[model samples]
Target: MAVVNIRRDVEDQFYRYRMPLLQTKIEGRGNGIKTVVPNMSDIARALSRPPTYPTKFFGFELGAQTQVDDKNDRYIVNGAHQADALRKLLDDFITKFVLCGSCKNPETDLKIMKDGMIIRDCKACGKRSDVDMRHKLTTFITKNPPPKKAKGSKGAGKAAGQSVEADGEGVASDEEDDDEMAKQIAKEAKDTPIAKTGKDADENVEWSVDTSEAAVRERAAQALSGSMQASLVLTPGDDEEEGEDENSPYSIFNQWLLANRPGGDEGRDDLASAEIYKKAQELGIEKKYKAVQVLLQALLTENAPAEVPKYGAVIAKMTTSEKHQKAALGAIERLAGITYPSLVPNGVPKILMALYQLDVLEEEVVQTWGKHVSKKYVDKETSKKVRKAAAPFLTWLEEADDDDEEEDLDDL
Candidate 1:
C-alpha cells in the first residue's frame, strides 16, 4: 500500500501523482520460472492504462513472453525479473509513450493521426509531439487500441471531470424508505393490537377504516422509484469518424521542410542542420533519405568539421545509388570551400571512411575522387585545408586496394 512518485526521479514527497510500489512475485522453477506482477492492475489503474500495456512493455524490454488475463486479473512474464528492474523499465516506458515530449508532463493522450503516426497531445502545454515511429511498441499500440468510452459514463471525458453520484444517491434513498416503512409497521402494530377481541365488543364502538402498513409502504416505494427515474438519457460513443488525406512521401518531406524553414521568414533559404535532421525523422523512415542534400548542406555550414561523422551516418543511409554517392561526395567537396570553418584537418577522411563502411560510397569513386583536388566551397586556402584533411584517408584507400589484391593472389 506504500506509494511512490510516478516519476520517481522528482524525489519530492509532496508530489501529487503517485502509484503503489511495484509488487512482483516469482513463480515456477528452473526453465519454467516466471514473474507474476501481483499489483499490475493497481499500478496500471494509477497510471490510467490497461494492465496489459505495462505487462507487454515488460515483455518487450526483458525479451520474454507475457500473458494478460483480464478475467482472472493475472499478468505473467516468462522469466524471473527483479521488481526494481521492472520498475526502472517502466519509467522508460513512461518517457517514450506516456509523457509529452515538449512539456515533459504525464497529462497527455495517445492519438493516432490520419497518417498513422502516433502523437502525444499534452493537456498542459497544448503541444502535439510526434512519437518516434521506429519504436517496437508503436506496432502494438496501433494494433490493439484502447476501447472507446461512452460519453455519459463517469470519468468519460476530461481527466479532471467529476463523476455522477446517482448510484450512491439511489442506495441512500432506498435505505431511508426501508427505515421509514419499518417504523410505520411497528407503530401500526402497537396501535391496532388485539383486534379480534375488540371486534366482538366493538358493535357499540365506532371503527375508522385505514390501509394496512404493507399497502402504504408499497405505494410510497413505487412513488419514490418513479421520481428517481431520469427524464432524459444520452449515450456516448467514439467521435474519430473522419479519415485524413494520405500524402506521398515526397510531399510529406516537402511539408516538413516548409514547416521548419530555418528562419521565421519564409524567404530565408538557409537552415540549421541539427534542426533539419531532428525534424526529418518525423517524415518517418521512408522519406528521411530525401532530405540528405539539404541535411548535408546544413551540416556543412553549421556543424564543425570534426562533427561530420555524426551527421554523416544519417545522410549516408539516404544514398541508394552510385549517382547519390557521387552527389554526397560532391556536396562534401563543395562545402569544403565555403567560408564557414572547413572540416577539421581530417574531417573529410572520417566522413569518407564512415560512408564507405556503410556501403554508401563505393571504393572506386572514393579512390578516384581523392586523387583529384576540387575547390567549390569557399576559396583556395580553405579548399587546401579540406584536401589536406582527406590526404591520409586517401592514402589508406589506395593501399587498401593493394592489400586486397595481395589477399586475392594468396587465395589463388
Candidate 2:
C-alpha cells in the first residue's frame, strides 16, 4: 500500500511543532522590509525521517502503518500516519503562495508575496474592505500542485522520502516513512484473495490483535507488581513497629528468609535480601539463649529431675571461669520460679553426677566478743533455716549423720 500525508495547508500536523519562543526570529535577506520565515531545511530534514522528535507527532506514531489501494494507476493516500507528508505539503504550499484575498492585500505580511494586483476594496461604498476567497494565502496551496520531490525518494508525490511509480502511484517504504510498515501489510491483505467463509488466511496475522492486547496487559502488571522502591538491604531496628500491611514485601521476604537458615548448601550461599531477612527473623523468635538457661535450671540450679546437657559448654562463652560462681548464683535466681520438676523420670542421674562438683556453701551468723571465741555465737533457728534451703542437695551428709544416729535409740 502507498503512504500519503495530509493535503496541502496543514503544516501544524507535524512540522512547525517545536516549542515556540516568546519571539522567534527567522533569517532573511531584507530585500525591502524585514519579515520572518520558518527554516525550510530544518523542517525538511525533520520530516524526511521517522522518530524525528518525540516518539509520536501530534498524537500519531510517525512510523505507524495504514492500509492503502494497490491499483497500479490509481493513488490512494491512507488517512493513518500521514502527518509527515501532510506537514511538508503544507509548508511548501504556504511558502510559495502569499497575499490576502479579501482585499487583494499587498504582501506586507512576511508570509505572502504581492504582485501589485488590483485592490478589491469597495471604494464606492466608503472603501469597505472585501475578501477574495479564491486566491487567499492559506487556500492557495490547495489549488496549486504539491512541491516537486527529489528523485530516489520513496513516496515523492505525497511528501518527503515518498516515491511515485510510472502509474502516478506512491509507495511508502517505511525506511523512508516507517509509519507505512503497517500500511504495507494492509496492502498485502487487500491484494490477497479471500478464502471460503470459514477458512482463515495467515493464522499469525489473525492472532496479532490478541498478542497486542496481551502485551499491554503484561506491561500493566509489571508496573503494578512490586513494593515501593526502597533499599533492599533492610537495616536492623527499622521502624517495623509502624502498622505494616500483611502483603508488604519486607514481611514476605522476612518469612522467606526464615524458611532458609544461615549456612545452607554451598549453592545457596549467595542469598538474596529476602532469604537473609527470613533468617534474621527466625533468630529473633528462637530465643536460644533463654531456652538453654531453662534446661540448665531444671538440672543443677533448681534440683529438677531430668539430666540437662552440659550447660557449662553451651554457656561457656557467656560466663568464663572467673565469673562461673557469680553466673551460677545468677542462674539460680532466674530459675527459682521456673519449675520443670519431672527431671527424675527423664534424666536426673547425669545431673547429680555433674552437680557433685559444686561447693555446698551455707550462710553463717556469728557474734564474737573482742578476739574471744564463744559457744553462744551460733543460734539454732538460723542453723535450721540454712540447712533447709540445701536439704535436698545435701546427700553426702547422710553418711556423716549415720555415725551420730547409731546411738540415737538409747538417747531417745
Write the residue-wise lDDT of candidate 2 on 163-191 in tens digits. Answer: 34532332222112222332333333333
The total of clashing pairs for model 1 equals 7
lDDT of 1 by residue, 175-264 (tens): 122334333333433332222211112244454435799876774454323211210011111221111122533344444544344432
Report the Cα lDDT for residue 280, model 1.
56
Please give the lDDT score at residue 90 for candidate 1: 88
Q: Deviation in angstroms for 84 in model 2?
A: 68
The runs of at least 3 residues in candidate 2 whose Cα sits more than 4 Å from the true structure, single-residue gaps closed, are 1-305, 310-312, 315-319, 333-336, 341-353, 357-389, 395-412
Each model's number of backbone clashes? 7, 25
